[model samples]
Target: MASTRQIITDLRAQARALDGRHLSGSMMDGVCRSLRRGADELDRLLGELAMLRAFAEIPGDAE
Candidate 1:
């Protein structure tokens, strides 16, 4: 299975390919925007997960 980061990379590539083609007000334009937003969301999710992992790795007072 592909990792989240890898998926985001592919998504960004696809988005870039669809971008800036003067397809304003068209379905392809909408698709490109949606793909970009999806990638942005996934990136944020990865950051949140990494932050949680870092917190988990820290030494706790109870430990």
Candidate 2:
């Protein structure tokens, strides 16, 4: 699986491409919106994964 940071980075790149001149204004708007949504979702997933990892490791922690 790609890391959350990697996913977000890729999404940003996609957004940049959408903003480039080849895309029409309306199409660029749609693509940027979709990419933003994807980035948000990826961030949520990463947070959840971090919580789960912490939960799983708590029992063995000595401090």
Candidate 3:
């Protein structure tokens, strides 16, 4: 699976590319909205990943 950071980066790039090119009602508008949602989701996932890693490193933590 792709790392959360990388997934966010890809979504940001897609959003940038779609910026300023969509009309009021077009497919690109939907694409842009989806990309924004994807980026937000990835950010949340990254936070979860960090918490998991920190929990794993607790002293006396089990495998």
Please give the clash total of every predicted structure, in order: 0, 0, 0
Q: Which stretches of candidate 2 lie above 4 Å from their native place? A: 20-26, 58-63
For each candidate, give its TM-score against the true structure. Answer: 0.74, 0.68, 0.66
Tens digits of per-residue lDDT for model 1, 1-63: 788888999998998898766565555777788888999999999887777767888533221
Top-TM-score candidate index: 1
Please write out the lDDT profile of model 2 over residues 1-63, one tens digit for every residue. Answer: 775688899998888777644543345777787898999888888777777778887532222
Model 3 lDDT per residue over 1-63, tens place: 775677788998998899768566664867888898999987987677668878777542222
- Residue 45 deviation, candidate 3, in Å? 0.9
Q: After superposition, how far is residue 53 of candidate 2 from its true place, in Å?
A: 0.9
Instruction: State the lDDT at 27 in candidate 1.
Output: 51
Q: Supply the TM-score for candidate 2.
A: 0.68
Between the candidate structures 1 and 2, which one is better when assessed by lDDT? 1
Task: Give the whole-model CA lDDT for all candidates, comma-separated.
Answer: 0.79, 0.74, 0.76
Q: Give the lDDT of residue 43 in candidate 2.
A: 85
Q: What order do you get sorting by lDDT, best first?
A: 1, 3, 2
